[model samples]
Target chain A: MKQILAVDDSMSMRMLLRASLTAAGFKVEEAEDGRAALEWLDNNSPTLVITDINMPRLDGFGLIAELRARDRFRDIPVLVLTTESSPEKKARAREAGATGWIVKPFDPEKLAAAVRRVTH
Target chain B: MLSALATEPRTRRHTIMQGESEVSSDQRMVLSTVLGSCIACCLFDPTLALGGMNHFLLPTPPEGRGEDRGEAERYGIYAMEVLVNAMLTRGASRATMRAHLYGGANLHEGMRAIGSKNAQFARDFLAADRIQLVREDTGGVLARRLELQPASGRVRCRHVAEHVPDGRPAAPPPSSGHVELF
Candidate 1:
């Protein structure tokens, strides 16, 4: 089974992501922020990373940049799921190397479809 | 703003923040939000007496700006879709749907014209979907406080800014706080 690292500061959002992804037939690992996500990456390799932009320790942009800079995690696709819909923020994420962006309050089907698209 | 309407036994006022939405079938339910550059789209279906409102921060997602589709769903599109879907799930029909748009004020100087873009996007979306736009108050230099009674399809918009950038006093709200739908 493919594993996905879901990172966010909100416990509720994390739980929702876990439930949705698990229901979609993927194993899910979680982190409270980008820093913890990095720590998890030290010991595990997820097929993809889904993250929120505003987080403590490290934000989504920093996480994507860090991952892109590292040879080990360079190939993993990163999807940003955030409430911020500003064009500036989207461009920043793209510049930082995010594979895709999904706004919050995501549909389970669309989320699953996006995950499947990126993972495949 | 909603407290005044709470006198009714079944009336519930809900304040939605940015990137959020609410749908209700109760005739007394009132939805409210504060807006600057963000927009609030209130959609109502008179046939079912059902309605919903959504607040979104931007006009489009990354793909709208020529980027790859890449799993993007911007708040403007997402909020509208979600609200409309919720209303439909509750038995509302598209043919009877009506739309009201508020906000899209350019609250700051020398900034990107996000407010106008957001307002235009809402207009285009409603037009494309063949939804009737009954009313609109958009594109100014001040923020606003908006309230909508979904089932009645009545809306009240009040300027929240104390003064305009040109130093003129802001316009006063309607003497009557509410607009009754006949």
Candidate 2:
């Protein structure tokens, strides 16, 4: 099974992600913030990193920058799952090495399709 | 801010109905709305003097309910995203954005707590996006009337008592009734 790391501060959102991804046949690891995500990444390598943009401490942008800076994590695809869909935000995510952008209230089927596309 | 604007005549006023959003860079425009078991988010970027407001009926579309993309703005997820994007179109940046939340009253005692859920969604959305939430007035059993000056980031919220079947105003529960500053 493909492994994924989902980072978000909202418990409800995390639960939704877990339920949706697990049902989609992927094993998902969870983190509350970008800092926690980094801590998790230190010991584990997931096929993909899905993150929320705004969070306490380190945010998704910082996390992406950190991932891009390190050789080991640099190749892993990062998907931004956020409520923001502005052109500026999207460009910034791409500049920071994001593989894709998915807006919030994502449909489970669409999200699964996105994951499969990136992982494959 | 509300008090300071009391005497200044608002040049334009727009009413934001439920499931609608409006953004403006004009300092003269003020957005107003009324809420019950709903939420209104006021977002402003002081640097650009641009802002927007959204009134959503629910936190997210009902799971597995076949919500289409066109009507997604009725939910918090799309409402907030659309509002932010609208502000950005007017040259506002997220880094300098500040937010204020209002409404979310559980007026119906025995029914589902939709109001609290909406309020929680707003809080989570703001936190997840790293927007600075400077003011919030949510929960309780009374509806609210809100006025927001998007460009100036000024807000005024008034808690209105719920009306009973007999048409008399219902007394507020002891735990509620505090005013939120702009």
Candidate 3:
């Protein structure tokens, strides 16, 4: 099974995402915020990282920058799942090395397709 | 309904759901709810002392889920329309309407940004209907608890913390299953 790291501050959202991703056959690991996601990254190598933009402490952009700075995680695909839709925000994510962006309230199939697009 | 009505002697508090809306001419009637990614639009007419509120989870329902599913209320179009119609029925003139929008938080990371979409939909919906948007607090990471006084058109917003402090027991999750309020 492919391992994927899911990061979000909302427990309900995490539960929904986990249910969707697990149903799609991906093994999912969850972190509540960017800082916790970094902690998880220290011990685990996920095939892909799905992250939300706005978070306490470290945010999605900060996480992407931190990951890109490290050689081990440099090439790993990072997809931003956030409620932000401004063109400037999307540009910033791309500049920070995000592989793709998906707006929130995603269904199972849309999420699975995005994962497949980035990982495969 | 009785509890909300009983409290009406002083102040009436109404907690509405995703597809639900309420309109009132009473200054003591306060409408409130906690939102994750959904959008709540509050409409009020100063001249008529009429106010209304609606909460919507999505901009539009899924393609195949038709009106018979009773899911239309979950979409912005239906929610906004219902609110406007209710206000009109209560003697609010559309020409004097003003709007205040809240919610649309990106509470969950690594998922579609439904909150932003909902907020955008609200702005467009209001604009298309020519309702002046007087106030807005939307698009953030924190979930919010919002209260609106329809008659006075006053609003209060409080940010909800995402996690309980270390060693503290978390609040019990809301019960699953449909709860019908009569």
Candidate 4:
């Protein structure tokens, strides 16, 4: 099964994403923030990374930048799952090397489709 | 879920709907609401121990929208006014009142973040009314379940995830004419 790392500050959001991704047949891992996500990356490599932008310690942009600067994770796809829809934020995420962006209250099917687009 | 009530059996609970406001001096009454891309303002008078809350879907309704008084409550202006007036009527003094804000989650991506806009409007409205905003938890991608105890002016906010059931394709985004309330 494909492995995916999901990161968000909210527990409910993490639970919801886990449920959706697991139901779609992907093995999912969880992290609470960008810092924790980095720690997870230290020992494990997943097929793709899904993250939220606003967080307490470190953020999605920082995580993407960190991943891009590292040789081992440079080409890995990172999708931003957030509530931010501003054009400025989107452009910033793109410049930081995000693979895709999905807004909050996302449909499970659309999330799966986006995941498939980036991972496969 | 009235889990809070289970712990405190004496607490009275009430759910405030969209475009609605409730005020009371009853120490046992708890007003609650769930928000997604919406805003809820809780106002309280420290001196009088009277408080109220309002849930609004938008900052303003469209031009030439329905003139019914009920329709007006959906806008921030009316919602704030109604909440304040209700509190005042219940012996809350404006000079001694403060506000707390919650909700305003951006539930959808691609579309404009109406939640942010609503949060801004709420701040502006409170400032314009000269009400001090004591606390705020707003503007994110997750939904919130909020409970406000009017008399004690205590509030609890819990983040909740949005669930999209399997086999149910997401519904198409709605147009301005079809604004749905939560």
Q: In order, what lDDT does every prediction score?
A: 0.74, 0.77, 0.73, 0.75
For residues A1-120, what per-residue lDDT tens digits would candidate 3 score against the true structure? 889999976554566578779988999999978999999999999999998777667889999999999999998999887655567877898889888887554545667877887788
Chain B only, TM-score of each candidate: 0.76, 0.82, 0.81, 0.82
**DockQ of every candidate structure:** 0.02, 0.09, 0.01, 0.01
Where model 2 places Cα greater than 4 Å from the true spot, the runs are: A9-12, A53-62, A86-92, B1-7, B17-27, B42-52, B77-101, B105-144, B151-153, B158-182
Q: Which candidate is the best by TM-score?
A: 2
> Evaluated with lDDT, which candidate comes out highest?
2
Candidate 4 docking category?
incorrect
- Position B151, candidate 2: lDDT: 74
Selected candidate, larger DockQ, 2 vs 3: 2
Q: Count the backbone clashes (under 3 Å) in each candidate.
A: 0, 1, 9, 2
Q: Write the residue-wise lDDT of candidate 4 on A1-120 in tens digits.
A: 999999976555576689779988899999988999999999999999998887647889999999999999999989987655566877898999998877554556667877887788
lDDT of 1 by residue, B125-182 (tens): 7775556888888989888888888776667788876642211211221211111111
- TM-score for chain A in each prediction: 0.99, 0.98, 0.97, 0.98
DockQ value of candidate 2: 0.09
Cα error of candidate 2 at position B74, Å: 1.9
